[model samples]
Every structure is written in C-alpha cells, then in structure tokens.
Target chain A: MATSTPTPDTPAGPTPTEARHRRIGELFWSSDPNELRPWEERFTLSATLLLLLLLLGSPATVPTTLLAVTGLVARDLLHRTWFWMAVAATFPLGLLRMSWLAWDNHHFLLLYWIVAIAITRLAAEPDEQLRRSARLLLGLTFLFATLWKLGTPDFRSGEFFAYLTVSDPRIANVLVALGLQDGTVVPTLAAELRQLEPGADAALPIAPGVWRVAELLAWATIAVEGAIAALYLAPLTSRWRWLRDAALVAFVLVTYPVAPVSGFGWLLVSMGLMATSLTGRRRTTLYLGAFLAIAVFTERNAVRNAIEQVLSLLPGVG
Target chain B: MGAIGRFTGLVAPLALVLVAVLQVWGVTQHDLSQWKGGGFGMFSTVDANANRVLDVRLVTEEGAFPLTPAELVGVAPQGTGRFVSGTLTLPTDDRLDRIAELAERSAWYLDEQGAATSDPSSASPQLEVQAVEVTVYRPVPDRADQRLRFEPIAHRRLESPA
Candidate 1:
C-alpha cells in the first residue's frame, strides 16, 4: 500500500481526541468482525447486550421501552453518551410508575450501572472511567449486602434461611433433595401457615435438621460474600487480582443455581467482566461462559435440576 | 472537561450514597422492608412480601368478615397485587386509602353461603359493606417454641361511600 506524504499544511498525525474517537469507533464498527478488540470495547458490547436482555425480559413503561427499542434498532447509538443518559433517566421513572417497592434489588443495580455507563462515556478517558466505576460499584454492592446481613438479627441468627427454606419452593427443593429437610414437611407447614389468623402466635413444627442446615448455609453465605467483598475492595496487586475474578465467578456459579436470581447473577457477571483485563483469552472466555451460563440457569434451571436428579438416583433419596 | 462532564462523573458515586441513605431511611422512618429499596440487601433478611400478611375485612351492619382471596380479586382485579405489595413495603396511609377505595367500589357482596357475587337478585342474603379495614402484619420468629408470630405493623379503616 502506498502511503500519502504529509504536506506542510497537514498535521503530523491524528490528534489525541481524534485517535480516542477512532479507537471507540473501531470497537463497535470493526472492518474485520473477527478482529480482537480491547477489553473496554468488549465490556461495552457485553454490557449493552445484557441491558437489552434485561429490558426485554422485564419491559418497563412505554417511554423507557420506546427509548430502549430505539437504541436497539440503531446499534450505532449504543456508543453515544446521550442515548444512555436518556435511557437512565427514564429507567427510575418506569420503576416509580410500577411502584418502587415492587422492584427487586437487581432492578436498582441495573439503573445504577446504566447511569455509570452514561457518566463514564462523558469522561476524557472513558475506558479507565468505566473500569473504575465498575470496580467500585461491584465492591460496594457486596459490602452493603454483607453489612446488612450482619446487622439483621434474623439473618445473623440463621432464622431467615430457616424460614426461607420452608417458604421458598426453589430453596426448599434443593434443601429437600440434599436431605436437609423432609420433603413432606414444607407442604405441611405451608398449609398450616395459610390457615393462620393475623396477629396469631403460632408455632409451626420444623425438622431439627433444617435449622442446622440453615445455620451452615448462613455462615457459608456470609463467608463467600465477605470474601468477595474484601477481594474486590482491596488494592489490586498483580498476584492477587486474579482472586477477584475467581471469587466473583465462583459466587455466580454456586449462588445462581440455588437462588434462581438470574438477573442479579447476570448483573454481577457483567460488572466482573467490566472490571477484568483482557490479558488472557481464557479470562475473556470464562466471563462469556459465565454470562451464558446464567441465562441457561434462569431459563432451564439446569444446574439445580441436574443436582436434584443426581441426588435422587442415590439409594433412599427422593 | 466541561462542567457537565465533571458533574456527570459524580453521578455513580452520588447514586450509591443516595441508595444507601434512602434504604436506611426507609427502614427507620418508614416501615419499608429491608429486602427492597435497592441497598443491595437481597437475601439478607426475611422481612419481605412473602412474610407480610394482609388482613383485609369488609364491615357491614351484620358485622366484620374477612375478605376471601376470591373477594379480593373480585373487588380489585388490577389493583389488588399492587395494593398488597405497596402496603407490605411501606404500609403508608396512601396505600391503605387506595385499598379502601377499591373495597368500596366492589360490586360483589357476600351471599348467604358466604360466597362472593355481584347479583343482587340472588335468593341468598347479601351482606352490604359499610366499611373496609386493612391490617398489615409481619412475621417474628420465636426461638423458644420454633414459632413464627405475626405482629400487626399497620392498620387502616375507612367507611364505605354512601
């Protein structure tokens, strides 16, 4: 290829802002589709896809839906700060219209992440801004969750999980299959609970083993969450940085199967993907695999069901 | 950077602080459930909608009777879920008033068999409601007897429209 010589009137090369814009454009509009992009570019693409999935999975009010659809139809708008700003602005309004109390924690997380993306896009160093925001957001999320659990008497006493194990069918199923609870106990307790009068002092019988199991689960949950929080919040050292990704991925893999909060799991994975570097192909693949796995887990309950099936095959098991 | 850009950079941090403050305010000032309002407190507490009990009743000259699931659906086809969930989270007067309004608007009445119906000409006796009462209760676990006791957190009563 023949290169054109720069004339006296021409500047030496692309200015810094032009180069930055070019890099951003190349991220979204690559000449070769298979060409590898930077981690920030990959994160932008992944997060956009995740946001679209969330919006479609739970359609917001008319304005929010229309704005999101507009962005989806015009893929080029995904990189624009104004597009995200409009979306973020309408997100909370949609939540308010639906009644904020009705929204789950993950819904709020989605809103914050959307706002974070919009704000970061406006920074001079968008990539660095995005990475820092993701790290802080993820760390704060786990930190607050842990602190809340620690502060709550019911949660700390293991009574919360004990009660949930009986009330929530998803958790009950896994606990039942694992021999932590009697299969017939939950149904019996549920029927009795339905008949209870308001303001009544009632004692529903529970299997002793369930309390023990709940205590174990409670501690394990705290340990895992606390570990992840500490790892993400700590100053990153080259040697220990890998632990953050490992802890996050492990949390997703282990928690989502039983918890069935696929939206939360997906959001966590998206944040993790954003914070991680693209130093290794394997790391990128792991994040992609995790994101897909969460979808599969949500749609099919594959991992939970598989565990149940395997346990049932054992002698004396359900 | 422009002024807008600098302000935009603060959005994420500011949002985090706002969420935390609101979450705590909700728990302390209002009786908002800890499981909600976006403090990232999911799976941290049992004080969620599932543990909240709504005691809804229709009061007539005949006396007060609890509203059955069917009656609730009949009275507020669209608003029932929203009202219940809202009351569970905040249990504010506004939500209670909405529930009262829905209960007054209900055309269905309890027949002689205690079943809900909209037909006034039915042979069975009809219970005409003069008022609506709603009480929201939350579960408190008792370790002494392995009991989950429901204590009333909020209550509201409104006379039905003439």
Candidate 2:
C-alpha cells in the first residue's frame, strides 16, 4: 500500500488542521482518476446542449441567440477554453436580461457556470482534484435537497407529492393511467369559473390509491436523494464502487421521468457518470449511450407524452 | 501547470463551496425557491398550510375572461418559467402578484399583437382589457375532484396610461 507517511522532504507531517483540510478535500474535492474513470468528452457535449437548450427555450431575444450560438460553436469544436469563457460571460448576461420568471434558466446557468469554472481549474490542477470538486458539488446538491425536503412537513407526510399528482395535469395523467386516480372534472370549480364572471375557489378529492402512490413516491424521492448523498460523500462506497455507480444510474432513470427536467437531469448524470470505472471501450460506450438515451428521454416532451398515451390505451386504463 | 493555473485550481473549489453556502443562505432567506434544477432546495418543500390554487383571469373593458397558462406564455414569454413550473403546487401570494404582473404585461402585448382587433368591423367594438383577478381554489381533504372549492383571491388593475 502507498503509505500516508511523509518523506524526509517534509520532516513534519501535516498539522492537525492541515490534515483535516486535506482529508476533507480528499473526500469531497479530490478528482482521483484512479478512484473512478475518465469522463468522456461527451459529458462536456451534454452540458453544452443543456446550456444551449436553456438559451433556446428562453423568450426569443438577441442576447440569448448570440449566447446559444457561441456555446454551440465552442462545444462543437470541443474547445474547453472557449467554452468556459463563453459560459463565464453568459452568467452576467443571463442574469441581467433573462426573465427572472423563468428561473430554471437562471438555475441552469448557475449550474453550468460552476461546471465551467471547475473545468477550467481541471486544466491546471490534477484531474482528480477537479473530479473531487465535481463530486462535492453533486454531493452537496443531493444532501441539501434531502435536508430541505425533510424539513418540509408536507414532504414528510407525502402530502406534497399527493397534491402535485392531483393538481398537475401531467402527473394526473400518469396517475389516471395507473388506476391510482380518476380524472373527474370538478363541477363546482368549473361552474364557478364562468368565462366572464368573477372566478370562484374550489377543492377536489384525491383517491386513496393515489395518496398511497404519492406516499411511495415521496419516500422514494427521499430515499434516492439520501442514497445519492451517501454515494458521493462517503468513502466506504468506493470499495463497492459498482453498487454506488448503479444507484446513481438508477436514481437518474427512476426520477427523471417523473420530474422530466431534461437539462438538469443530463447535467447530474454527466457529473455522476464520472464516479464509475470505465475499464473498457465497450463498457464506456454503453455507459455513455445509456446516459445519452436518458438525456433524450427526459428532455423530449413529445416522446414521453406519446409513450404515456400508448401506455394509457392499454386495457383497464382510462 | 504554471503559477496562474495552480492558483486557479485552488480558487475554483473554494468558489464552488462559497456558491453552495450562499445558496443555502438564500433558501433560509426565502430569496430563492425550489431546487428543481441542480443547485439547491428545489421542490424539496411545499407550504402545505397554504393549500390554495389561484386561477387567473383577465378583465377587459368589454368583460372578464379566463387567462390560461398557455395564453400567458404566448403573451408574456419572459414571465412564464416559474408560472409554468408552479402549476404543480398551490398558488401563493407571491405567485398571485406574478400573475397580476404578467397579465398587465400581456395586456399591452395583446394590443400590440392585434388580439383585440382580429375582426375590427364588429358591431360591438372590442375594448382593451384593464385588469387581472386570481380565483383561489383549495383541495377538499379526502374529497373527490368534484368537491374541490375555489373563490376569488385577489384582483389588480393593469397600469394603463392616461
């Protein structure tokens, strides 16, 4: 085993404080290539596409168009320096002009902004250090999300997801197909909403089955988030790296469809994929392909809706 | 790596940590909501006590009409991101304010888009819309879809010029 002991070049080992910082750094920010695998160039490509789609989806504007084209060219040529510079520049541009209403644009912009900075650092630092930073970022995201959800009373009781399933049309459609919910129009709400009248307030009931599913989904979300947190933060999981990587992939698969924020999902998967070992060309290709499929699946609404429509047509589904 | 490169490697990780810390603080301040994308606390919590939906409608000089989300997006593309995302939850006071703002913004947009003068030669000339109102709805706990209750929560007039 390579020893932790210091050589004569440094007579004294790291001080307690320095050792703590180094240990924390190793756990969270070390980007050890040996610990995991080489991330494919495609991760950068996927990140670029996410940033591009965000610009495209924003209300048609000159700045958005310019930024999108710049990002596209940078990614196409696989120019990290140019890509990072463009991303760095877009942060303020996006903040100043992009509507605060479409806050996802801001979120995506912020996410890529961090990644671009980390990538630039990676060029100078050891790859492992950058990898560790990426892992730290991903880990903190999951950890904070889990904590926030846990702190919410509704999420604890599954009421949040329950309400979403009943109120959100997309989620309701899925629930209806699964026989967990019945899509009956609320006559009172409808009657109160006469086109030219002062609209009235209304309440709708949720089926017990739907509630049960909501509870399951709620717990599942917490579980997956908690698991992902552990995967990235804990060193113990490295011994059983396959399990950790599998959980990451599974988390992406199970959660992305329900939430369907493709850009964010791709960013997470790209960062998460680096945690797994890519020992062979074939394995890496398959891994990259699977993630790409997930990216496409989550991003494209028509594809998901078409699949849902076909599934809803099955016998016993209304 | 040169001196500049080495300096960047040290700075980058620290910057990321700072960003994460600030995001946590923002959440505590409620300055930001939902960590749905890859940043912080999105869809992590809901204000369950405030369980009411705000259905927005536009009030014109001619009459009041419902403003669907799609219409809002079409008219005020800039303000529709969170509005579209917020469809999954109960409408809050902040959200109502946003809707009112969008309605006011879109009122001018509608005029510019010639929505009112689609058939300008009609007997009753279409008048420009003036305000927006939100109809609030609450889910009847353990009740069916038909039993959901709703009422007008708030209304605001557009900032039309004299």
Highest-lDDT candidate? 1
Docking class of 1: medium
lDDT of 1 by residue, A120-188 (tens): 888777666777777777888888888888888888778888888777788878877887777776788
List where candidate 1 sits over 4 angstroms from the true fold. Answer: A1-37, A60-77, A89-97, A301-318, B2-10, B59-62, B104-110, B113-131, B159-162
Which lDDT tens digits does candidate 2 get at residues A1-318? 122566777465668975664454343223221233234342443345445545633332465457557556544333355555655555556544643423552354344434545454445544554456556656666776787777766676677777677566777788677777677533332444343222333354666776677778778888888888887777754457666567777777776666766656655655654445443444345455656666566667666787789989999875
Q: Interface root mean square deviation for model 2, in Å?
A: 5.6
Q: After superposition, how far is residue B87 of candidate 2 from its true place, in Å?
A: 15
Per-residue lDDT tens digits of candidate 1, residues B1-162?
Answer: 565554454577568868877998888787888888888777877778667888778888777778765567665767677767778888887887777777767765566777556667666666678888988888887655898888888889998768
Model 1 residue B75 lDDT? 54
Off by over 4 Å in 2: A1-83, A90-96, A113-123, A185-201, A236-238, A299-318, B1-32, B35-39, B45-162
